[model samples]
Target: MQRTADRLLREPLDCYDDGAIEEGDLSVIRLALEQFHHAVADRRAVIGTGSTDIPPMQARQT
Candidate 1:
């Protein structure tokens, strides 16, 4: 899934550099993004939120 996400990101830029993208290409790009979204959600579930490890920010006086 990570590889798919990387490919979708890199290939489209390469395609745009070469020439204009067609409807078919746009459809594939959209689908790839949807798949990547799901992949990220799955990863987040496995990793859980690490927010608790971060220290609270202190406000600075002007």
Candidate 2:
């Protein structure tokens, strides 16, 4: 999960804010995502699960 996050940060993804996201803001987003995923993993680890099935984050195109 961490690897995927890192790759995503390195790749070019869209910013829904149009032009609101600046160069400096990327690090902040990256750090936040890292922390969030780490926390999720930690929480899942405590639950004695063989694997964690994280749901995909997608928006409905209705």
Winner by lDDT = 2
Q: After superposition, how far is residue 30 of candidate 1 from its true place, in Å?
A: 0.7
Relative to the true structure, how large is the alpha-carbon lDDT of every model? 0.59, 0.60
Tens digit of lDDT per residue, candidate 2, span 1-62? 76877577644335524554565666676566757666776788898765555545443232
Maximum-TM-score candidate: 2
Question: What is the lDDT, from 0 to 100, of the residue 42 in candidate 1?
Answer: 67
At residue 20, give the lDDT of candidate 1.
Answer: 67
State each candidate's clash count: 0, 0
lDDT of 1 by residue, 1-62 (tens): 65866675777756755666654665666665666666666676778943323233332232
Error of 2 at 9 (Å): 13
| TM-score for predicted model 2 compared with the true structure | 0.48
